[model samples]
Target: MKSRRAILAELFLTAASLMALFPLAWMVSVSLMPPHDAVGFPPPLWPSHPTLANYRELFAHQNMGRYVLNSLIVASLATVLSLAFNVAAGYAFAKLRFAGRDRIFRGLLAALIIPGQLSMLPLFFLMKELGLLNSYGGVVVPFMASLFGIFLVRQYALGLPDEMLQAARVDGASEVQIFLKIVLPNLRPIMVTLGVFTFLSAWNDFLWPLIVLSHDQLYTLPLAVASLSREHVQDSAMVMAGAVVTTAPVLVLFLALQRHYVRGLLAGSVKG
Candidate 1:
């Protein structure tokens, strides 16, 4: 039988979980309500008559389908690029011997303390100079690599057996061959975690896309949802539906891959 303290702890955790989930549940509930049913002085906890009209209207009139496609393209590209760049850099940092390698990594760690917002001006100017503004490339460029990604992969890669890599080299396997054949397979867990992270970040990103993408057709789901809010300010139900649409994909992806993500994160943390 469970101890009283354990039961209390379980009850407390359940309550906390409910509290955390309440807002998301309410958002879903309000999305199914009638057009203006959620705008009252006392907001509703449940829809009186559930309906799919809000979702239909969003896809029909707001060009939400295009926005979802745009988001998918950007997020998928960003995930691929992030894996390509970060995994290589991280493995190099963890296993390779090179002059200034430690110094460079230390500098990167130091730079993490600096706020990302401060770099927007320079990044914007650079994007403009490259003529990538208002393009898909502009949206995907910033996510090609990230400091946290490198850090996480580096930590996980540090746990890889060095003897195997040395043996492969002794057998005349080139560095590229070893990395492709050996390192990549071993790095799957962290790769999944990083891919999920990059996809979600790129999918939900609004500020950078907002700044770089000026045309309405180039808008991502978050940006489209924000625009929809302005255009339908009084249609709370429709806006909630847009929010649900914007959130659903990433939420599902995370839920599906949560085990791998948690395992990778925990392994990286302990190894680091």
Candidate 2:
């Protein structure tokens, strides 16, 4: 049942996948290698003497566990807050009637084109003024409500049956109760998509956290990995191990939830 073209396409895709994955695979392989073995010309693909020494060095000497915990705390808080704010705002934009709603949403959508970097200075100053600087709240607050998140949720929520919402309203359900009881359950796919997006963004964030967190105790995994690279410049294997540790959790989370993420994107794209 397969044509030559189909076979060729499959082969091309397989090759592309392997090519994309090769570097990550090599990173893991190098992480397992002994120090300096990875820096050799024509680096070996497999470790001759695999060991956990680099990981041990990272956790034991570098205090990497604290960084991991910090990242977890920041990312979890950001994801939860992003869901809370973006979901409500998005649903309101989609289904609720309010004065100036369209104009406000249009202004937000227009803002999507502006570079996010431009806002950093003002945001930093705002954080400083609020006394949130140099704290976890500083890292989490900026990402708690994002325009893209609002747009994604709004687009997906547009597809929800208006009749169901109206019926809930007629039954004398308060807006909060209706949203909690009716809307949230229907918005599961998009919620997962948004949550995963927020979590990954917060987890891997480097620059904002770097600027905001002053204490070594507050360093996140990306910052920790960067610092490790600086301290262990010659120890490529150790650096690779640090990279692996920084990358692995989010990679696992994405792989686990990719189906839902893809479905949400697809549904949102067409629903509006």
Candidate 3:
């Protein structure tokens, strides 16, 4: 009876998992279906006949390729720049002695409690004043560093051996050299984890890019996909294709680095 119950439970869990993933599966199935086949009176769970016509249409006429490139460049740049800024500030907060460091960090932590949206109106105006509006810099500048990123790095760095830093100091190594040579190598795992987090966040960001980038030419994938959805409401297959293109890279990145990502989450939660 116990064995039978266990088997039943497993089946139930598997069904639940499938249910959760059904939308994604359906999206892919429909995207591969013939353009008109997806929107029948009763939607088909599986494609009757699969075709690449929707994908071809997305790239050929919709200029989705440019949007993909925009997302890639913006996401990559944001990740790299955020990593540099946060890692440096985090390491300083963790290892270096300075006046008011703890107080400043506490202030930042408090600031994190406020929603990012609260700053958007002011931030947009600031970008406009700097002539960064409608440019990549406008989207990338505000996100170059983050309070959460700094906090995460500081937590990880706090656990690192201080003796290694002292050894580097004793050797007359400058702060920058010690950070580059001694600290950065040891930070590889956290860096990978942080980079993934930053990349995903930036890539998936919709509202800021939508507000800042008025030019269709500068639209990232999410923005472009949204625009396509509005313009091509009848083209369910094509819109799903766009969503697949927009979501696939980040999904792949997450699946590949999920272990590190989970570890970082745990470390941050426990340490903070």
Q: How far does residue 86 in candidate 3 sit from its true spot (Å)?
A: 0.2
Task: Report the C-alpha lDDT of model 1 over 11-125, residue by residue, as the tens digit.
Answer: 9999999999998989899999977677773358898999999999989988889989999999999999999999999999999999999999999987777776788889999
What residue pairs are clashing in model 3?
Answer: none
How close is every model to the real structure, measured as TM-score? Answer: 0.92, 0.92, 0.95
Compare the candidates by TM-score and give the number of the best one: 3
lDDT, each prediction: 0.90, 0.89, 0.89
TM-score of 1: 0.92
| Candidate 3: stretches off by over 4 Å | 1-8
Per-residue lDDT of candidate 3, residues 124-242 (tens digit): 99989999999988998767989888988988899889988998899999999999988999888889988988888899998999889999999999999999999888788899999
Candidate 1 lDDT score relative to the true structure: 0.90
Superior candidate under TM-score, 1 versus 3: 3
- Model 2: per-residue Cα lDDT over 188-232, one tens digit each: 889999998889989999889888887888989998889888877
| Clashing residue pairs for model 2 | none
